[model samples]
Each structure stands twice: as structure tokens, then as C-alpha cells.
Target: MDKKEILDTLKAAQVYLSRLKSLDNELESAVKQIINTFEETERNIHDTFSNLKVVLVNILNKRENFLLEQAKKAKTDGLAPLEECRNVISSKVVGTNKLITQGNSIINGSAKDGLAAFSKNASLLGSLPEVPELKEVPFISFHVDPTSDNEVKDILSQLGEVSRIAPIQITELCEKPGAILVEWHSVENDDRLTDIQEFRLQRAFGDVIKEKHLLVNFNDCYRGLDTQFLVKDLKVDQPYSFRVCCKFEGIQEWSPWSLPQVASTSLRPFSWKISDDFLLSNENKIAKPTVDSPKVLYSDGPQFCVGHSVEFTFLEIDSSNAMLGLIDQILPTSSSLTSTPGNSFLVDKSGKIFVDGIEKCTRLSEFSKGLKVCFTCDLVNDHKVRVNVDCNEKRVTYDWSIDPDYKMFFVSQFYSPNWKILVE
Candidate 1:
């Protein structure tokens, strides 16, 4: 063979050798996993059955004691009247016998006191001593259900089920400035049983996984069967471990949690980092108007980059103009948001949008209380950042001349007092 053919053959051999090595490693790992699973599953099963036994025993003992006490109570209650009647009859017998002895003594002896006693006793003998008549006595008895044993056995047979844990895995993890998006799926995707009821996602601060907080949906309940979820308001630039477990339709317990995956936010956790002449509280999440004049709010300065979004929720909006604006440079304390800086874009409650203080004809719905406004900066392989505004379910996109490398900050200003804005 030529040298080229020899080289090609060697390369083929090397490729096969690499594949063989990978397969061997996979086989070894699978064996180890199998061993661990076997031991762990066995131990879990043993503990489960042990607990079941204890519970069953306790139930049986409680029922047995209850029935025994019921029987004893029945016996005591039933014998009460019969015992009282017997005592009355015995008292009458004793009284009659004493009267008989007194009469016999009056007849057999010749004393005057005996005659007096006989006279007294004769009045008692005029009528026979009253004796209580015995009626039908109470019969106390307990009967067990004929089919109870068989019924208990049947119930025990159907009490609990043993099913293998579902293999749920986290498929994707995406990190944002203050959030992480997680997506997962079941490995055993059995289409025949579309009975997945819900899924639970838990997150811990570090890799130790000691304390975990269950993630809630926007409705503030545990997440349902959706495969993807975005956990927001997380601490930025902090490592968090997350795991997911699912509940099937008939399962009482959620399936075992998936192996934890760690993800950390970059840059900063988005919050209202600065405010314009307003009192900011709750880590700058809430802005309260301190002065009767117009107030402005600002997020972290120059840190808002591409692929990031800021949401503003109006908690209380008075009868005044609420403005949403963005600026690249730091605003001078002397400069007011109403002045509209030369390098800023704003959308006011009057439905007018402005670019660099120049009014644009784009009219959006007027802002109101309880209205959610989201501003997103997106640019894919482009120099200019595309700012998209979502308000009242209406979307308007604007391409700003600002370069993607040039970071900017979001601004919200209101004219009236008692205006509360929540920044996320």
C-alpha cells in the first residue's frame, strides 16, 4: 500500500479506537450508575414499607382498642338496671326474715316486750314485703363483620403502588441579568400517558442544596406542566442551583427532583439603581414620590445592554402625565426629566413619543394605573440597539442610533404626587 493509504488506514484505526474508548467509558459509567440506583432504590423501598407497616399496625391497634372499650361499656351499661333490681329483692328478703324472727320470738317467749314487738311486726306482715319484679334483662354482645377481614385484605392489597421514578431532566438553562430561564423534559416521553399534572422547580443559593425555595408562577402558585419557566428577580451574579420534579395525575407525591444544575446571572441583578429626587426603598424596587413636584426614576446606570428588558408597573398613577424615557449619559442633578435631554427618547401619557426632545407622530395608548410597560433592548449581529416598548398589549419598536456597545439607562417620570412605580 502507498504511504497515503497507510496514513488513511491509521487515521481510521485511531477514529475507531476513540469511539471504542468513549463507548467503554459510557459502559463503565452506566454500570456504576446502575449500582448506585440499585442500592438507593432498595433502601428507599425498605424505608417506605417499614413506615407503611408501622402505620398499618397503629391503625389496627387503635381500632382494636376502640372496639374492646365499646364492648366493655356495653356490658357495664346493660348490667346496671339488673344489679339494682337484685339489690332491692335482697333487701326485701332480709327484712322479711327479720320480721319472721321477731314474730317467732313473740310466739315462743312469754315476755310483754315480745308482744309489743309482735304487734309492731304484725303491721309489717299485714302486707307481704314489696319485691322488685325482674323484667327482660339486657343482653350485651358484640358481633364482628363477617367480611371485614377479607375487606381489610382487599384494601391492603390496593393500598399503595410501587412505580419507578420518572427520569426528568433539565434540557436548557439560559441566564439573564436578573433571571434564569430553565427548560426540561421527561426522558421517558410516553405519549400514551399524557397525565403529567404539574412540575415543581426549586432553587438554592449554592451548590450545597440545603435549603431550596419553590418557584412560583406569575399567579403565585406552583408552576404547572409547562416545560420552560423563567425565574425572575433573582440575585444577580450569584450562583444558584435548580432542580425540577413533576407530579403525575394519580401520583400522590411529586417525582424525585432532577439532578441540580447551577447557573449564575451576569453583570447585575436589574433593579431601580438610582432615583431622581425621590425616596427609593426596598432595594430600589419601589419609588415613592417625596416632593409635590414631578419625580423621576432610574435603573442601574449604563448597565442596560442588549437582550435585556426592564418592566415598570404603575401602582398608583394620579391624574398626571407619566413618562418613560431612556438616556445614555448621566443626567445632571440640575437637569429635569421634563426638560428631555438631547440624548434621550421618551413616551409620555399623552400618547406622544419623543426622540431627542423632537416629537414623533407615533401615538400609543395613554398610560394609566396598573398598566405594565416593558422595554426591551435587542440587537442581533447589529451595531444599533433596537428598543421595543410593550404597553397595554400593544408593541412599538424603535431603532436608536446608539451603538450596541453604548450602554444606556431607563427612566420613568411622573408629574403628580403619590405616584408609586415598581421597577423590576
Candidate 2:
């Protein structure tokens, strides 16, 4: 072979040698990783069981101390009366023995005037001590609570569990009004949903994302064996993210959290209802204004348990003074819905908003006939109710301290005759 061909052949051999060395190093690294993983898992399991042992020992020790005290007290109390009776009987025997000795001396004539001394105490010697006769021995036996052993065994059986890591992934997230339905499946792609003991679904606000599952303030929404869960009472149009983990039947540890999925709820519409006093036509959606003072019309559907939206369209708003709002309830003898202080929130014809019959803001939006005015209401952090009103492209948002015991409803007040409105 020529010199150049020989050099090329040597270089090829060097490349193959380097590749072989690289493979050897990779193999060594993988072995080290396996050893490290095993050590870590062992340490974690040991620590978990150790902590559980400490807690259980503390609880058992407390119970043991309590029972020991009770047993000791029972023994002392049971022995008390018996000891007293024994002492009384022993004293009487000693006295009787003394008298018998004196009498024996007298009979044998061993002492001067012994007979006379014995005769003087004869009545006392023959009389028995006033010891109460025992009918039945009071047996104080300490019977441990019958279920205590079973309870301990049951606790021990459930104390700690062994589990293998499960490969899981969230498949889909479906949105509903004020809720989200989360679905997941095993990464193995097998039908093992039934084999799982339970699944834990958690949710967090989208803005509160974190790198680790423990870092985020995630709330547990559901825990069960089902592969799907529906989380309810969420805010409307608000961004939320969800993740899931699962455990096997015999396993105590949960699988790692799945990648978070984001979703938002759409506006849910509710059916409207007006009182029979103002009924005119069309399933309580249409009502004629009473000639007397204005009365409020309320909804009969599901209360504002979650976020909802309602639209009020004035079919005829010419020269009619009307108000649209929400009220917690209407009293039967009430002259007007706004009569109950702080229970009513309303907006008037001149684009003014009122809370509890007190005006909050003026000229919020231009109110006119044939225009659709939509009211959007939702809870804010479970403490306040937020309402957004959109009228002819003008939007206004208001928040109020929500009464926990109150069930909210949509309401409107009208006094002008021939005034018509369509509620949707």
C-alpha cells in the first residue's frame, strides 16, 4: 500500500479506539447513576419510616402512661377497704388473745385474783369486733377498651406503605362554566386505571406557577380512583392550571405530578324568573310593569354559586325609569326590593350604580332602549363578589363584600306601565 493509504488506515483505527473508550466511560457513568439512585431511594424510605415510628411511639407512649395511671389507681382503691377490714379483725384477735390468756391463768390459779379479773372482762372478751361482714368481694379488674387492640393493629397496617413510581400524563382538560374537568392516563398506554388505588388532582392559579410541585400553592381538587375529575366553583374567565398524581392499591407514595394544563371557564347563562304578581308572558322572561310602585323581578334558577352572566334587553325604554341589579332575597311583605338595607345592588337609568340604596358611581354607562345590557358576576377569592356591567360597549366593574349566607339572584325594578324587557 502507498504511504497516504497507510496513514488513512491508521487514523481510522484511532477513531474506532476513541469510540470504544467513550462507550466504556458511558457504561461506567450509568452504573454510578444506578448506585446513586438506589442509595437515595433507600435513604428516603428509611427517613419516612423513622419519622412515622417517632410519631406512633409518641402516641402509644401517651396511651400507655394514661392506662398505667388508671390501673395503679384502681389497685389502690380496690385494696383500701379490704386493708381496713383486715386491720380491724387483727386488732380484735389480739384483744381476744389477751383475754383468753387471763382466763387461762384464772382457771389454773396461777395469779392472785386472776379469776376475779377474768370475770370482769368476760363480756368484753366474748364480744366480737363490729367488722362488717363481707357479702361478695369487690373485684376491680382493669378491662382495656375492647377495640384498642384492633385499633392499634389497624393503625399499624395502614401506617406506612411501599410504592413504585408510576409513569403518568394528563391527556386532556375540558372547560365548563365555573369548572374544569381533568383527565389523565398511564404513560404505559395500558388500561390500568382500575388497578390504581386513587388519583390526586390539584389546581393552582396560572400566575402562581413554580418549578417544583411542592413550591406552588396548589389546592387539592379531587382524590379518587377515577381517571377523570370535575373541579367546581372556580372563577369565570380566570386562568387556572391543573396537575395530577396517583397511587397504587398497596403503595403509599404518589406518582410524580403531571405537566400542568391551563384552562378557563366560559360564561354560564341562567334562566330568569319573575314573581307571579308581574307575570305577563313567556316563561317569566317577559313582564309588564305594575301601575303601582316598581317591584323587583328575581331569577329562579341555580343561585350564583359560581360565575354567571345575564343579559337584560329593554324592548321599550322610552320615558321609563327602571333599574337593573342583584338582590340576596325578597321579603314577602316588602314594599320594594331595595327596602332591605345593604341587601340590594342596583343601577339606574342615568348610568348610576347604587349599593343598598346608596349611589356609588354616576354615569357608569349610557342606558337606552333596544340596547343589550349584560351583567357578569363572579366570586373573588371566596370573600367578595365582583360584578361587571357591559352596556353599549361601556364596561364598569364593581366589587362588594359578599354575604356568606345569602343566595344571590338577578333582579330588575320597573314602575312605568307598558314598559317591556326581555331577560336572557
Candidate 3:
């Protein structure tokens, strides 16, 4: 054959194959469409049959009711209303009664809600929460923490529908005028402050207040401070079971804390764990991060070029303990650094004495210094004496001439070390 004839034959074969592929795609699309239509038709048929079944059942029920009504009339009781005649036939005739029974059963079985939906004892299975009696109104008078209104609402809602819980009112017992005071009332139920812990409104140590001791003429063993007036938000006219004691003039002693006291009426709160790590932790920075913060440590301070981790020196507080903070190391004494020579007491220029190379404690003032820590001994001579230290590294700088000054008001003066001159 010629070259043109060979090329023409190849073109024909390629066109035939293209047409066959196109036909196959069309056939597949048509088959999928037919299948989808069939499924849709089947679903529609099922829905139509379900709806028809309901309609048929309603019609048959009406027919039965009407036929029974006619039969009731034939008995000649002469009921006037159609509904009344149906009810009579439904109750009286055996077959009609069966229909009536089944109809009632249908409603009972099909209907849902309230006591009707539940099996016998299902209502009993779930107990009605004990309704709290309002012996005392839900009062806002207590050591309230920083509680928001929304938090109070949440607590009240859980206890029961709060008929009424009043807002906070502040006042203080007369003696401690600066201290906080509040009062709240529950008009309807004892639901206020029931779950103070859950509401994030419980009090803590940092909350401070002044208290008054009022001894009323009323002699009650249960009440103390003669009257431990409300302080730190403690309630008044409220029975508190606490151990308390008091001391008077010459040789008086404090009383012991009394037993538990309860308000007139309160909900028995469910026991909860004492840990407040969740709510209070956010306010206090003590919630240490497991991962270091200020995330990107800067290169401003150069670390050692060779080591993988840094080695820092912390003052050794105990020979056994491995770790210490800067504050923990400073609080302890330098007792291990004291020195002593064999027992002759010598006095320093400041009228303090020295025995073995250490000092002897002669005066009350001298005892306040490190001289008391040294071994107790009498002066070697009938005379008082003095010694001096010129060494730069001694680190001993206490002067025994003046007493460590202090005030009676504070347990210890924070800024002065002299205040640490602990009483024996």
C-alpha cells in the first residue's frame, strides 16, 4: 500500500477507540442515575405507607366507636349525647370494652412524659432532695471571701429555688470599727453559702481583722470571749461551737476552745477535699510552672562554654540537705563558726570578757551577744575586764553595752536583728 493509505487506516482505528470509551462513560452515568431514582422511589413508598397506616387506623377507630354508639342506643337507655353513648357501649359491651381497653393501653404505651413515662417506683428511684426548713434566713453575715453575685446565684440555684437571698451589707462590731461586717437573709430556703468552696468564696489566712471581747451579763458556757464579738466576719447571735478561754488581772489564764456550734438551720454540706489549689492558686504566684516561663532565656549573661548544665553554689544549711534557697540559708545561726580556748574568763574593752580565745558572759547585755552561746564560766579575777578584736575577717560585730531595743506591740520587729534577742 502507499504511505497515505497506511496513515488513513491508523486514524480510523484511533477514532473508533475514542467513541467506544465515550459510550462506556455515558452508560455508567445512566446506570447510576437509575439506581438513585429507584432508591428515592422506595423511600417515598415507605413513608406513604406509614402515613396511610395511621390514617386507616384512625378511620377504623372512628367507625368502631360509631357502630358501638348505635348498638348502645338499641339497648334503649336513651343516652342523648353521641360521646356519652359511645362511652356507655365501650364500658358495657364485652367486645367494645376490649376495644376501649386496647385504646387506653395504646395511649399508656405510646405516650411519654411525667409519671406516665416511668415504670413503677421510677419516681421513687430518684429521691426528692430534702427541703430545707428555714429556721434562720440565708444570711450574708459571715466571713465572706471575694464572692461575686454570679457565684452566689450558682450556689443558691443548686440548693433549691431561692425564694430570696439578700445582697451584702457591711458593718462591724463597735470595738473593731475597721473590720468588715455583712448580713444576708434567706426568706424562702436555707440555700445561701451552702457550697462556699465550690463557689470559690471561702476565707483564708491572709484575710485579717480586729476582734472585740464583750462579756455580756448572760453566762453561757457555750459562748466565750465573755462575748467573742463577730470578728473576721464571724456571725453574731449565731451559736458557734468553739473552745475558748480568758485571763483576768493577776494570774489569769486563757480559756480553751469550745465544741462545734451550728446556726439555727443549715444544709448538711457534702464533705469536700480541703485543697484549694484550683481557685486560690491563680491569685497567689506559688502555683509554680513546671516549664520555665520568660520562655526565651536570653544570652545577655554568659554561661560556661564547656558544661551542658550550670552548677550554682547555694549556702549549705544542713550537711544532709542538698538544696537551699537564699533566704533559708540566712535564717540559721553561724554556731558552727564559734571558737573557744580552755576555761579562763577574759573581759573585752567593751567590758565583755574573754576566756579561752572566746568571750565570757558577765552582764545581761553581754549575754544578749554571742557570749551566751559560748560555754558558761565565771570571771578568772574579782575585777571586771575588757578585750578587743582588730581582725578584719572576724565577722563578729555585736556591742553588749546597750540592750537589744524592742517594742511590746509586735511579736518581733522585722527590720531590726536586735528584736531577735529572744526571751528565755
Candidate 4:
């Protein structure tokens, strides 16, 4: 009951209070994390279900409309002949009845009247139309199975249990020409599998009901951790939806598919057929026009259609003497490269835009590595040409009048291994 005893008791109380505070802080942190996880799970599930509902409804509606249209058309066609036959039969019956009535009147009339009636009956009989032959109209029958509802119910019952494995999180999706790269991460601290084994990537493109789904497996390539998979051989500029799932080495069941990621592949490179007017120098990397050769390399693809543009991506630009333009006439192989041909529109590397060997615009742009230059020929609008140069995140465009009678080509009179271009 002295001062030392009281101080000792207060110190013990303080230690207890500090421990309780630490426990409370830990509990709050755990609660917040759990709440966040639950919210994410709920959102994902709801979104998936909603999307599935919309897709199913759309499919069902389309099928219903198609079948209804078919049935309606069949009904209209089937009834047309039947209606015509009915009208013909009705007319014949009326004529026969008239003839019968006239014959009866003649039998019951006096001599003069009977003679008149007999003539009338004869006329009626002669004027009657011939009975047309009735051909059988084929009937359309649509069969409906009464047990289909039960069959669907049975199939639904056999879909098995909902997977307990956490869904994959898509981290990155890159679209390239003829290919797509999909990267994903599994749920952290997932204890469903002791060691990760394999992952399955599935993709659906075009009409879901018609297109065959694609499935690729990454077994040894992935060490059961977060990784990426490149899907190749895909059609360019086609939209595709993808999902991922995983399985343990010893487990039989695979995790449920991840949320769908939809993207379209990049446009395919232009089908460029290099002409022999230019020599392939520097290990066939650079196109150089010789002095005695035509300074033009034409593409075998179709001419620039209306609103269709051509883009060139420069991987390397070692020379600034390149010329891009359209030519109306194919110059002879012995033509000199010093003068631009007539009926041509050329853009040179020195920022000179020329039309028919005359300077049109001096606002030309230089090229660099990883730069894209696009030329759009607007033949519909008085044969105008629009040139767009994209470099270093900057773009510049120039508009110039052009001759519609010319074809386009790329001309360069230099040899450099670092001068490569891709036409898109």
C-alpha cells in the first residue's frame, strides 16, 4: 500500500494497454485487406455473369428471329397456290350450279318457256370453264422435341462444381501483325496447388458459335509462376477474346478461365513485291537504283484506291536522298536518275515536294529510324495527295495536288545496310 507498490501496478497496466493497441492495429489491417479482396471478387463475378447473360440473350434472339423469318416465308409460299386453287374451284362450282338451275327450270316450264330455258341451259353449260387439275402442295413441318427441356436440365446438372481456384489476372495484352502476346499473374498466396505446373490459354474470335475456339498449353515453358504466352498464326486485323486457366501437375481439374480480354490484331504489312528496277544491295537490305536502271520500284499490289493510304515505317535511314512519288509512264531502263520524270509527283529527303519535275512544296520532312511516313492519295478530291510524317512523337502533314494517271513508287540511289523500310 506504499508509493513503490502503486508505481509498479501502473507500469504493468501500461504494458497491457500497449499490447492491446498493437493487436487492434493488426485486426484493422486484416479487415481492410479482406474487404478489398471481397469487393474485387464480387465485381469480377458480377461483370462476368452480366456479360454472359447479354451474350446468351443476343444469340437466342438471333436464332429466334431467323427461324421465325424462315417459317413465315414458308407459310406465305405454301398458301399462295392453295388460295389460287380455292378460287378456281369456287368459280367452277358456281357455273355448274347455274347450269343445274337452268336445266330444272326448263323441265318445269311450258313449251315455249321450256324451249327458251333449254337453250339457256345449253349456253350456260357450254360457257362453263374447264376444271383445272389440282396438284398437291407440299406441307412444311417443324418438329419440336418435348424432352428437350429435360435434356437441358440434365446437362446443366452435369456441369460439375464451381472451381475454388482463384481466377488469373491479365497483366498485359499486346497486339501485333498476325500475333498477340498475353501476360497474366496467378493469385498471390494461393495454396490450392503446392507447385504450379501448367497454364491453358483459350481464345475465341469472330462468331462465337461458328468459330472454332483455340486452346494452347504452356507446360514446361512456364514454371507455374506469372508468365506470358505469345499466340501466333492469327489473322491480321481480326478481333479476338482470350482467357487463361491453370492446373497443378498432380491435380486433375483446371482452374476456371480468367476474365475475357478482347483485342484486335494489327493490320497486316502491305504485300510489297519489289521490282527489279532497283538492285538489292548491302546483303539485300537496301534498295539502290542504278544509273542505267529506272529509278523506281513499283509494288505489285493494287493501285492506291480511294481513301486507301500507304504507310512506310523506317527501321533505319542512312541516306536522305530517297524519293517517293507517282509515275504515269514507266520510264525506259536506260533513263537517267538526275531528272524527275514527267507526270510524276515526288517528295525528296531535302524537304522538296515536286510535281511533274516542278517544285510544289518545300515543307518536306526528313526520315529517321522507327519513323512512319504515310501518303494518302485522295483521287476522289481532284487527285490530291496528303503526306504525313511521324517522328519523335511529332506529326506533320502536307497537302499537294497530283496527277491521277500515275502509279506510285519508292526510289533511292544509295546502298546502306541500315536503310530498311516496312510498307504497311
- lDDT by residue (1-424, candidate 4, tens digit) is 8999999999989999999999999999778756755786778777877886798789889988988898889989878876887787788677678767767766676233556655655664554434345455556667767699688668656744444445566677876434676898876576754566777777676533234343332122233455686665567777777777788768777777665567766634334446555544432334544434244455443344334455666665665456554555556665533375555556565656666677764454576667666665555356666655444455555554664444454333333334555554
Clashing pairs in 2: none
In model 1, which regions exceed 4 Å deviation?
1-34, 91-137, 143-155, 159-163, 167-169, 185-198, 208-227, 235-237, 246-255, 271-307, 314-322, 325-346, 351-365, 368-371, 376-389, 392-422
Clash count list over all predictions: 0, 0, 30, 0
131-211 per-residue lDDT for model 1 (tens digits): 434455455667778699789889778855444544678888888667887888888756623788888877766653333
- Per-candidate Cα lDDT values, in order, are 0.74, 0.71, 0.29, 0.59
Over 4 Å off, model 2: 1-44, 113-117, 125-135, 138-151, 154-158, 162-168, 173-200, 206-210, 220-241, 245-424
Model 1 clash pairs?
none
**Candidate scoring better on TM-score of 1 and 4:** 1
Clashes of 1: 0
The residue-level lDDT of candidate 3 at 165 comes to 18
**What is the C-alpha RMSD, rounded to one decimal, of candidate 2?**
17.7
Distance from true location, Cα of 51 in model 3, Å: 1.6
Order by lDDT, highest first: 1, 2, 4, 3
The prediction achieving the highest lDDT against the true structure is: 1
lDDT of 1: 0.74
Query: TM-scores, in order shown?
Result: 0.64, 0.42, 0.17, 0.35
Estimate candidate 2's alpha-carbon lDDT, on a 0 to 1 scale: 0.71
